[model samples]
Target: MKLAAATPAAAQVKADELGQIPVLMYHRIMVKPQQSLDRSTTELYDELTRLAKDGYVPITAAQFVSGRIDVPAGKHPVVLTFDDSTPGHFGLDAQGNPKPDTAVGVIERVAHENPGFRPVATFYLNKDLFGMDELQAAAGLKWLVQHGYEVANHTMSHPDLSHLTKDQVHKEISGMEDEIVKMTGAHTTTFAYPFGVAPHKPAWAEKLDGSYAFQGIFLAGWRPSVSPFDGKFDRWAIDRVRSEGKVKEDDCKQFCSTAWLDYLDKHPDERYTSDGDPNTVTFPNVLEDRLAKPYRAWARVY
Candidate 1:
């Protein structure tokens, strides 16, 4: 399969047209029966409602890859993403790992209640994280893919790609792509760099070659729309904005803060560039410093 670059149309489109597609990264939406994110179902529903009222569109992987984020195309075009292949997503087992039944239950309920707003989620997983049965993995994959969801790569063993050799990185990246395609019959192009580390900054690594064979649908690292082609490294880097727990109503008052959105829209060259420069000075230096520190904090764990 031929991997292609993002369309020139995307670049020409105004920030008003593209808007702020906040890719919200989440993991284990539902915790083990006894263990949870200290949040209740009512609370989760409220958060979703609040986001909806704020004009956030929970876009799907397919919609995102296709650049179809136009409806309710306001200031916020948030993408809801889930990481890890935990069975607890299905529900927890006796050992507290995810159970297929539990996880699918949460997804099914969400799908049922949302009607036309079927929230599409991406599952980045290790091949071995599923059940012992290979057929089960294949079947489970087919089930999710057939639904409105997409499965992308999370590496073979979930190692820090920045620290590994180029060949080793290729193995981890391509091996998982091969596995997903073999199981689901679709070309797997996206990859979440194991722990959000790029071969730059404190990760202290060099950039790797862009995949000539795989077309990445989405990945992690760069902020929305920024690419590595210009001067920055890792075009595969697709940055996500994270929302932790429930913030006060006042805290998120401008949840879809028009001012911030307006600034981004006006300064599209800084944030959403196809020119290939990932590191552009856009936000205030102090705030940028604050944001950069967290991403670094996030990458070190892997």
Candidate 2:
């Protein structure tokens, strides 16, 4: 069912299109949560289930940056971003189905169980290419793109860009683009900085002299992103919240996905709530100052 952003029923749902949206970053899925970045199969499954039950729908990173979101009215858009492209992130078994314990596997299961939960996500690729061989990586890339998943450049070597020279930085970014072109005959328009940190110049990641370009470059930050239509939005350094449970260290106890999601639930007006439409941005009149000038024509106030 299609829904317009300015529908009268939007009031009941408190559609705040100008509010923040969670862009959750994940690294790997494993049998054991040995590392802070690792999520067990059960943890991944349960977390996604919680998101679905809370009225969130998965959208690709490209869609989020391009502002092409179109989830049902009253349902918010959440971006599921898996970095490192680890072996446990995606794979196929004998029947060519996603391995049940992998990130994609868990997401597929959740979407199958929830009526409006879509099995879509963005995978950031590094040189290792999901720890698969050339043939396998090629097939995996094809499968992911064919299945509505977004594959983005995450540099050839996942080095901290801050330590690399200008030439090295360009190579790191362009090398990944070359791989995507070699495998898929196409290149990704979006990118994520390795370690979620850009080089000293930063602009190098956003573009490489005309050889490549990106619409958005994500960062490893500790908060939900401002709406793309908001004045505070930055395509070059969009903030992404790390996906993890409570932890007292690194301020994860308060800034992690689990904690922030809880806070958003209690303070519902702070998070972005869809008006079931993509063509317009709906929010209260008081937030008028927060809307970006370019998107002002699309803004609708209650």
Winning candidate number (lDDT): 2
What is the TM-score (0 to 1) of candidate 2?
0.96
Predicted candidate 2 versus true structure: per-residue lDDT over 1-302, tens digit per residue? 12224668666678898888999999988989788788899988988999999999999999999998888888989999999989999998888899898999999999999989999999999989877899989999999999999999999889999999999999988988999989988879789888787899988778877567899999999999999989999999999999888888678889999999999999899989988879888887778888888887787777
TM-score of each: 0.59, 0.96
* Prediction-by-prediction clash tally: 15, 0
- Total backbone clashes of model 2? 0
**Cα misplacement distance, residue 260 of candidate 1 (Å):** 10
Local accuracy of candidate 1 as per-residue lDDT tens digits, 1-302: 21223234332332222123556554554432343322334434545555555444555554554443444312345566656666543333456333434444454555456554445567777767454367667877876777667677777787876677767776676677678878988865455655666533322222235431433434442234432222332334556644344244323322323333434456643443221122221222222322333133211100
**Predicted structure with the largest TM-score when compared to the true one:** 2
Worst 10 residues of 1 by lDDT: 293-302
